[model samples]
Target: MKYIVKLNFEVDGSVDKPDVIGAIFGQTENLFGQEFDLRELQDKGRLGRIIVDIKNKGGKIEGYIEIPSNLDRVETVLIASMVESVEKVGPYNAKFELKEIEDVRAEKLKKIIDRAKEILTTWTKEKNLDIKEVINEISGAVKTGEIIEFGPERLPAGPDVYSDPNLIIVEGRADIINLLRYGYKNTVAVEGASGKIPHSVVELSKSKKTVIAFLDGDHGGDMILKDLINANVKIDFVARAPVGREVEELTGKEIAKSLSNMVPFSQYLKKQQESTISVQPRVESVITEAKEQQAVQVIEQPRKEIEIKIPSTVMEEIKKLPGTLEGIIFDETWNPVERVQVRDIISKLETITNGNASFIIFDGVITQRLLELAASKNVKLVVGVRIGGINKKPENVKILTLADVIGP
Candidate 1:
């Protein structure tokens, strides 16, 4: 069912202020335990009219929004509550009324998504050419004959091997095999491009700063290539097998060479400056260059002034530590900045390994973003001799908070 709710207000006194109207709505949202998204209500709140239709009772609310035409009863209550709360805000009396529309054809949510994915898959299959090429690549990558599984907790191993992003996509165990072959071991694969991209993939992708699409070359590969592009993923790059090759089909050395060549989204864009490709790297050259450049530039040391007033005993303890966390990343002049821009460096993890990364033993507070970045990069652990809670361990990601990565 579709519904339109109209809010008409009359102030009790001679006062006309647009900000007041907005204030009323804002207060109403807070008072009623409602979330207000202005874009959702923009027409009514700003242009002052709205038609809302919802499959479920509640989403969130903004100060403004464009609502669909129909809604379930629960949603109607939420909308109604908005008007009641606003009425109190203006010191003005407000009235809200709803209108409904019945039975119209809208694509099933799943159907729209599937179609979008299908259309976008065109880009992923071909690094720069035909869809047939992508399908062939996928079928070839799948030939290695190993099974890979993905579920809530016991996820697949190795690199993420899907063309589409906005989801943690993967291909087959063999694809995983090739990635592992290159020491590119922290990835997840869906086994084949046949299944729906899972919810877990969606969750993981949404939680990241960047997504690197790694797929083998083939026709099925092309299909998914298009699917990901069509799905409107904010993908960073598409890394693919080289011409006339599949990851599993390649020798370990060849795979290693290919892995070394993966590219970034920015690089991919440079390659397909004109094509409709979803843009992963060409793999062999791109991945290798990408990783190597990353490793060398991981921590930039420069000097910055920070007041370090420590108890004499604690100050002496620092001198006894090995590979102490006191290294610095620079601020352009090659001088040390007080703290490692840990968040800045950590955020670069397009994809991270599970448990093998160098640890950071620092002194002082670890910001939340830095902790998140560390966890994303799978940097082993964060050990601080000084007191800090900046990086709280989130449930989806993990980090060991220690006085020392080993122990005090």
Candidate 2:
């Protein structure tokens, strides 16, 4: 059962409904302790939303308030009395008069009676549907049933992944489901941004007639593709989800459109390199200026270097790494913690909190975004293949390049 407390109030000067409601809560907070606190009552579903209707006239305000309460009569009456005792709304003096307490159960019963007939009529009509609905349901079940776990990783794949000569590699399990819905029976998912590409996927790619890496149209997708390349997976063609879209969310027509526009992997990489080279000079200038400023600051106050010796074996391993866009995080003891594609480095840093990682070494350009993330995680040093332009240098985090540390 619910009770509606009808209230009438007048403010000396104009005030809004929020001001009046806030005054009620603030004035009555400590009057009855935790049990009867307005916020607690509302949170426990003992109080319904407060409704206020106010009008301004000649710089004064008048309003009618409605508060529905599920509390017992005695408790609700106590609450009403508390609201009536509110002395002000904002800076304006106010007077609240409790007009009446109304039992709302009767009104709710009437509403339920009125709605029952309409609902019954709609339900009767819907009970008589055509066989088309059943057929569609069966068809959907069949399509979803065609999905299978392809390999040891239990990655989502279409039933024909092993049988089909060509393969489509997509970003995740959802992408596989979406492709299966569109009758593409040779699709498989890479799962997630795992440091190593799934061994099953790599072996399968090598066996297919042509492996198409179908990726989302986002930085994360680009990073996954880079990881695939760095893992030496044989990818022939690359298809991208439409700009600002994801594979799982695309319509059937969109999926077809993107597949039709697939480009050779080599051509795609060349285009990306050209774009990076075009911006290189300006980025280099910014880096040089930032380095010069850093040098000035260092000369002003000489600081001791906290060096962690790198083993020659590890240096050789880093040199043998395949791609230019990879990274590894090291603990304070010079032990490797995590390896990630460069584009995903920022995301990796954000997941691990301060004191977990001390050093980061990557074969990619380091930018200001990377520096800020490293600084937040209290990383001591970042060594990249090249350092990109940064407007401001973060204190306490040292940025260097492989050339600066291990020499070219």
> Which consecutive 10 residues in model 2 have the weakest lDDT in total?
278-287
Q: Provide the lowest-lDDT 10-residue window in model 1.
A: 300-309
Q: What tens-digit string does per-residue lDDT give for candidate 1 at 1-408?
A: 344444434344334345345654566544534234443445444223443322211332223223343445565557555554554424544333333322223346657888889877976664565454345445533432332345564445543433333332445444454444334544666434332555555555555535666665543455455445544545665767666344444544565555457677566667665564434533223435435543543432122122222345433444443222232222223232333422223433333344434344443234455567665654443444322222134333323323334353
lDDT of 2 by residue, 1-408 (tens): 489999999999988888989999999998988999999999999999999999998999998999999999999999999999999999989999999999888788888988998898999897876464445334543565677897898887999898888899986655765677567889987876444698898899888469999987754465577668767889999999876466765667788899999999888777767877422343344346656876876774356455556777678767743233457898877788899855567888889868889989886656677888888888998887544435567767877777676774
Report the Cα lDDT for residue 335, model 1: 30
Residue 98 error for model 2, in Å?
68
Q: Candidate 1 at 350: error in angstroms? A: 41
What TM-score does model 2 achieve against the real structure?
0.36
> TM per model?
0.28, 0.36
Task: Give me the displacement of residue 331 in model 2, in angstroms.
Answer: 43
Model 1: how far residue 374 lies from native, Å: 50
Report how far residue 330 has shifted in candidate 2, in Å: 41
